[model samples]
Target chain A: MFKKILFICLLPLVASAQETIYDSFVLAPGWTKLSFIPPESGTYTLPTYPKATNGNVINHKSEVKSLYQLYDNKITLLNFMYTTCTDINGCPLATAVFHKIQQKVSKDPVLSKKIRLLSLSFDPKNDTPDVLKLYATGTDKQLVDWQFLTSSSPELLDPILRGYQQRIVKEYDENGNYIGSISHILRVFLIDQEKNVRNIYSVSFLHPDLLINDIKTLLDPKTKNGTVIARSAN
Target chain B: MKKLISTLYGMLMSAFLAVALVPTQAFSDETCMSPYMAKIVGQEDYVYVWTLGQVGVGDEQDKLVTIAVNPNSPHYGNVIGHVSVGGRNEAHHSGFTDDRHYLWAATLDTSKIFIFDVHTNPNKPKLHKVITNFVKASGGIVGPHTTYALPGRMMISGLSNNQDFGGRTALVEYTNDGTYVATYHMPHDENLYGATKTGQIADGYGYDVRALPRRNVMITSSFTGWNNYMMNLGKLMGDSDAMKRFGNTVVVWDLHSRKPKKVFDVPGAPLEIRCAWGSQNNYCFTTTALTSQIWLIYEKDGEWQTESVGTIGDPAKIPLPVDISITADDKHLWVNTWNDGMTRVFDISDPHNAKEVYTKVIGDQVNMLSQSWDGKRVYFTSSLLANWDKADGPEKMPQFFKAYDYKDGELQFKFAIDFATEKLGMPHQMRFGAYSLYAKSPKDGAKVAELSK
Candidate 1:
């Protein structure tokens, strides 16, 4: 019986293993953007971005403004990053992707008029309004519309982070000594004109083209009761 | 005329050779392949076995034991290589990058993540780097349980938090190259699932995460932290306060945003999660370790819902359904009962009406279950929690890996490799490696490298 079982086990080895075709940007190089259709049944849709609870944000010009009011009936792509982030794939990647998106949208009249990007610095102390203004004013003229916002202090940013459910913790050593920096997940929220979060892009999926496709989907007109209802041109 | 005929004959011979060299389909279609996905497919050269030394006896730390898996190889069924990462940090689930180059393994206690460069050599895997400051980096989240790949990064779910160290936990993300990215906390305060009137499941220790990227949705199951799991089994059962420690909820997140969209109450510690194979099947299954039941998460008409699909063993005895593995066709599910030492196979062709098909005992204690790409072979490992693993059972034997042959709805035990006998420790997650390590000679089916005399 043991011999028979061993023989049977060896049978699978004689057979070929499963083929795994991974989804990658390289594999599907021609996929500039995705064309999605609302499913008829058993579908999943992202929840609308909740209204920004903590409205206290200081813009680059040092003016107090509500974070939610910045949406201003526009498609907002909001992300949190510090100016000093050195990780190539962390804050730097997000900033680069935002710049690419800005450059792409500037060419498309529909996207340029409808979408707005927000980069909020969670390190409020170091990234003051003046620092944010300096950080936003890069040589790239294409990023003119992108706004850099920050709070007055870590305390003021707490409610905003909590509302967004962004888990940010200060690093410490095994000896319990402070590491002087914060650890956080990179989440870029894509909010619609109605203040609903349509999607959140992480490091891997945070491509300019993918963001543009999602933006177009949200901008596309909806059919209600067999009538073509045009979305608000915000 | 003779020269023309010779040229035509040579072209025909070359065409025949090319056609014969192509690999034919001889394996069953199995899709979900992450940590276990080998770049070269069926010819898995090495098996990277996560082993824990005799921690209960204070003799060993957790390590990675590489065994030649190619049956025809000379080193087959032998421990040819090992990596001893000192400290018994309760090494659990591991995953591989999408490119199948690096293997990310984590320890629960210290949250120390070890990335092994499996591509360098299938047999001798080198420790590329280590993420040492997970606790400080992930803000108070401790105990990294599951390591899963998402594009170019690895998404890890924690089983405990530093503040309470009971159940409150968070899910963290990091670049595959060991850079800290961000964190998403599971729902603990409000009713995420809206199950009961209060809508609060209390504990939020995250155990497993599975996502449907196309649907832009991901689901996470909950398990208790190390402290709760390592507590005296009898004391934990008797203590009413301790009974409330295990997580009883599953949260669904927007995959793109990493935000919790829905939280459903799955009572009694849901451990392993296996999503169905295809994009059309917008459903996944998770086993409740404490309750001995299998729960199903499905989306209907754009709304998400969860339900108790089926029960695994006698709930009264708490058989402890610890690990779950699904077939490539999404027709069957293999669930391992840690306490009872039995692997139960369920026919999941119909999500709602699942039936138990087969059952077999592999050892005194069984925890993790990994299936081959073809779904024809199922691998079983014995060891759940060091202290909780059959501590008081009749037979306190060594932990081993039992390979079974699944044919026609039955699981027949084929062979067993004893890890405990060699004191190599307890094997947890078993992943496949590249075919180059175990390539066999075509003539006599001999492995290229000869084993040491």
Candidate 2:
């Protein structure tokens, strides 16, 4: 009953305008079969790319919180997205992949306790706290902690967007009116407990299997010292 | 007016969709940029050329030269802006970050990388950052050749090492903000670096690096090191010992783990690696400098394999195939032979058999080629190296930046900017810039009109 209600509520968000956009192009590999086998967890290392920046965000429950607070020493998968993103390969792909990660973690208690998935919206004007609340309905039942967050205004969101280097361009109509649509390259960041970004995944690299492998690699005890095993020179 | 508005609307919609929805490796502006970066789907406003400073040239300083390219713009076909970075550093190649906001131009001699902010003002690009510790930070990696974008980071291929200044080197990774991440050394005969030697040779020399993210593969081609590349071209060619230093292998890597998987013996210094744009194509092409043969690296029966597909012009002549660009459709390839001053188009429709379809003499010496997304407008530059550049007389090298319109199976001359005659330096690599990338429109008023006039 809960799943049906949640699906019904989310249908309108993706049905009319979004379905037309999504149907025009093929789905990204994250939605289909991953063409290549990902490297096994704990076998390879994910070097720290950049430091994940912290910003003020409003959660779906309308509570003000620092992004670092949500991180809370957990291995975080931070994704920038909006609720009404119509592109199948853009925000929808990130969200769907995150959903799969949540499902996989729900079955494994060890990973459930250590993982945090964040879907932060770049379009704060459209994706308000209340809207995200409704959009995030039924996520609480998942074992892994999943947070759908939005900012109160552009002022509060711009810093986080800039820090992550998430470039987005707002679409305009023929008469130069704001169309409530933002175009952005889909980027999902995997941040370690130290707030250092380990890896960034775009549409081609984003997949549940790869994400889980990276998460496990980060959680591996050998990697706790932040030392990557030197690749065999021979 | 209605037709104009409808056409404008159609263009705007197309641009929005292209920027919003296109996946990696789907569409690109220059047809050879990193798939991780955003592409200019419509008209590009500027072509930022990383130029090498000639000794007696106007500034005698390596500079980033910006040429206005949009035909609709008033200042089209003109050198509108330039920013010279102090001194000469053998400006060879430049690439944009994944966000398409910054351009990283590297120098082979100094191992210095100048990052330009192309987004703030596309016309007049400002130097954002200079990475001075590349050699030290990368642990002796020198001559950063190709600055490739991978997700949020830049992967730089090294031509030489500080220890010997020879061919053996490694690929260094850095964050977009110029923070060094890690280095993965190329596999040689003594140390395969966990990569299997499919062929006898496993020379770990490095030149260009490219990735096919869908296949989880990154490919690196090999070229000679600083000892030979910086030496006088005539002298180095005459000296057999220096000539023997040229790379003879191309290494295939696992993109995710940054590890070498296989090394294929592609004798004779493969300069550029251009992979097909089609999602299912799953193949890349490279041409040798000494052998003048086109080689195809493809996957067969779940194993990556390589074979000599076709010959460029004549191996006997040593045309010195330098750079190559593949069209977005993956049907045609533009190969630039620096020695013969010719740009050859190959019908790569059959990947296994690349037949030369057409040829055009670009200039006295052409080193680089960059084509537009539609493969309509092709751009060429004529500088290979400061020491190796061809010159009929002292200070008389025919360095130029030429633009051509490719339509109906032939190249129509559009315009040419003689770098030497204009007192500018030798222009090497050209990267496109646009105002639409940053959601800004071209400036309006008399300045643009006057510049155009």
Candidate 3:
């Protein structure tokens, strides 16, 4: 069953890779080489914008949980995505970057235990708890804690989307029949241990190396309000 | 030779058909809007004109005038609606938030920033919030000029300070919900603020702000203060002491940290800054008001540099370039010269050398220019300042909003609305609006989603 679900998930990606026209749209820098060097980790500061709001969610293990409980005392990188988003530069790009970050974090003993990754789905009707569980199959054994979550209904999901300022519009056909596709501006967020949103990343600024550096910056002891719980290897 | 000629003819016909058959995207807005804001990729439904209330015009209050521009609508080429703020406050510039849900219009004289909800009803924007304590909240930084959008906040540039009302000012940051975040002062000769001054002068003046996120660089251009801007144009020009007080520096800063990195000496009051949109394009163009020259701020050899690329009209004539708009392709730049009321187009394919290709007189005094994304539609407004505007005469209307269809390198006049005759105030800055930004169809009563709070 796991193999079958994985095959179904990887099918669209394979087809998209074969059919993509290189010049059709500009690939964001997160998918390619970064154009410039980022600033040193602790030399700069990320001022808090707003506190990350909480919502009721069902983790991949079919257990009910509060978003704040998952974010408790952990440096979190949260992204909103649907399982079937086919836009190469949209959800797939974010998931790919998160995957790369997970791989890099796994190599670092300290960072692997200090950070948490959350992928929450706004399409509750489509991505149920079981769907998220299947999607999060291989993440269980990873050193870093990666959780895939979804709500029971649109009512339960709306507040989380509103809190994050993540806007998504559902597509429909000429007859007003629902299409599975959703349109949104991709965003990834970085939350500190205290649940304050430190940074927001759009397509132009979403890179794994940049995310890792920001994570290290938040954990650096020299930073204001930052504890020296873990040190990152550069 | 005959076979080759036939083949060339066939290729030419195919190319012409390809060009003729493809539909024009028409997806652009005042091409220099904040990149973080949502864009109207289709036809814009309305143009919101931030008007400076003249003493005897209409209600004698600064108003947000909505002009229906989409040709498909019944009210096309007409003033559909308007909402007047209480009184005249010297309204100058306005911008939208990152989500494009609210329009923040700032007044230079009173330092009042008015926020209007453009998403709830794109056709008729209602006053949402007003920040009346800008001077007190920003710690004496006065005259908010540019309201630029960051990720989740608005970064505003100031023209003068409340202490001395001089050109020295700072940039203030505010959350989208109207809470003040912080204030960053510009680097001056007295306080370098850890920024490297690469030239002889650091005037610490502020007018416009733009950013290149990939390079982590945010740039600000300088203009004069309230003392000179609010003065009578004729008298101020004659006063040598006031004339010498214009800003002469442009500062580059680290975008993430909000810290100044380097300051370049770009004399003669650089008012508007338009950065190129191309992924690889790293340069921005700013035209000087006093010098009548185009200055390019670009990165070269891992260092940000400034160069005077070309001249606008004639320097001796003092064309006074006030507003500039670059095309989405970054190939052409439209520069509006206020003194001569002429708009010149420069071919800037080569960033180092910009050459003028076309020029046209827009009005008696044109101060703002906005072009569409496809370079097909151009919009112009003619009001620099409430006191600086040219008086209305029988022949020429100094305050007006004009639209033209740009095709084949010529501006075919589509329509014009004379503000004085229509009883509307002097129109200064124009921003585009569309219903689609909020997931609503253009049709009336279309199902609209609740925008994020």
Candidate 4:
């Protein structure tokens, strides 16, 4: 028992001390590395998807605008989630992942300037613009263009959901009592400057590297053909 | 007379506007985001392998093995380091978080998920924490198959539920910290339960799932869950009742609301789904293992449809196409056949119309395949499920890892690591690891760091 306790105490230390002989891969032969192209302004236009159906949305600031108005000639990562959702994989998961990506973009001016995030609540009855604003207060600290928007009512939100093919179903108990909450498959859409959906991210492929790389790809179309052509403007 | 003329003019104008709006659908153009190509630099290229060890095998445990796969690196193709979690816990698939820092690897049989710190040491991943009570946490969901990272959370697709080993399954969500979030059951059409005759498609088993955010769509394909996977494949195939147990449906979902839109029939164990990487490409491809056919799922005339475009191995012989991977350019797809260990490449330039261009037999049994970000280097592993593997014989090959270079339409085998000879156990899902190229942008740096740590 004493030995087992000691082993348990030292487990983390031993794990931390674990050594890895990772000889950083040489990008070239001479071992000297060149700086990559830092994110830069380019004439790249994100590929267009169908026009995002126009829907009335109230921003966290209590201002009303058409959903397309939020695009504003920049890339947008849009999702449908409520502020009260406690499901880690539903609204909370999307919010958390969106927050992480927002933070990532905040660090890069090129990305922050070109990309925007919009989280809309399907439960307009509960998640008022004020509630959404509270949920998004610290989310977009870098002010990396992250906003939480919601329709004034579920009736108004229906067309938007139908347009995007977003669906929601309520959950009920065996006793036939209304469960107050809902169930849904979490989804995130990548929209371009033209209001076209470029990519939709589900639970998979929603990572920062893939999302940022995709954003960079949209920013610079010349980087195609599988080479990571990162140039440092500095 | 003047009022009648005005009414006629208004009617004509409305008709003209409707026709003009109809053309916009055609001119919409293939709108897609080009895959972000990260230029590899110093310290940027390494492949992370989630290896599964066999029971009673050497070191009997699941491990995360990192390898340097860059062509220019001196240590290319060499195993850099590996961290083993004691116990042959059926570690099958793994995924990276949005930040690419934390990697969640799941064990199917034991219902456990282990988080590894891939960012700290890209090559040497340390087991950060282990969520051991997934069965209870997920409310009895079993056989966790895929671990996909969303922005701040991980979504896992389970093969079966606790109720019974039947086809019923659910998608379990959790915070990056492995806290239980909720479970979304795959919609079941109870009306079709007894109605499904033999060879007919029905929905239930959940295997691999992918999301299309732009379209607000999520798709999950069916595969046998825990109880079905552990049973003898040959015995199960012979039993008529057992044959019906295999999943035969692919479910489409609305991304925002997480509701099922449509469940299309995709017969014979559809294992993997690969959405076209090209921005304009709207269709995704999946392969049926039992039937040995390629299926295309796409939007046609505003409706989602599935068409079997091609076949790899003879369905009669059951070559079992286990995994399907598409090139970064969306020009070609690499389909791995488990029975004969052949990797077939198909031209997907026309997604709806795909043609097999190249075929290479890598080994006796190849299950999973991973390609580099640039689509130049391809890695292969041998191991599908522990019990479902081919019985021992000359054809019953040892588990191995082989890397190949695809250039000029030819697959050049670079190196092979035989786990059977080395007694390293079996190898499974493989994902590449890289450093955090993006800078930190957390509002409270200490708080974010603490959560991530």
TM-score of each model's B chain?
A: 0.86, 0.92, 0.91, 0.83
lDDT of 4 by residue, A139-169 (tens): 5446588888988888899999877656565
Q: How does model 1 fare in lDDT?
A: 0.68
lDDT for each candidate structure: 0.68, 0.84, 0.82, 0.66
Clashing residue pairs for model 3: B27-B41
* Cα displacement (Å) at residue B349, model 4: 1.8
Off by over 4 Å in 3: A1-24, A226-234, B1-29, B392-397, B444-453
Per-residue CA lDDT of model 1 for B1-453, tens digit only, reads 435533543454344333333432223322344422223335455678887656553258888888766677777667787898777877877887654667889887778998898755666788899899999988989889788877546789999888877878889987656767777778766533322222445455689998776566788999887678768777778889888788898888777546577778789888888887543677889988788888899988877788999998899998888888877567888888887888898999999877898888877788887766666667778877666655543125658887776777677776778875666778888887753322222233444332100
lDDT of 3 by residue, B379-398 (tens): 99999997787766423557
| Candidate with maximal DockQ | 2
DockQ of each: 0.02, 0.32, 0.25, 0.02
Considering lDDT, which of the candidate structures 1 and 4 is the better prediction for this target?
Answer: 1
Show where candidate 4 strays beyond 4 Å. Answer: A1-234, B1-44, B191-200, B391-396, B436-453
Clashing pairs in 2: none
User: What TM-score does model 3 achieve against the real structure?
Assistant: 0.90
Report how far off residue B96 is in candidate 4 (Å): 0.9
**C-alpha displacement of B13 in model 4, angstroms?**
31
Candidates ranked, most accurate by lDDT first: 2, 3, 1, 4
- Show what share of the native A-B interface contacts model 3 retains: 0.21
| Model 2: number of backbone collisions | 0
Best by lDDT: 2
Question: How displaced is residue A226 in candidate 1, in Å?
Answer: 36
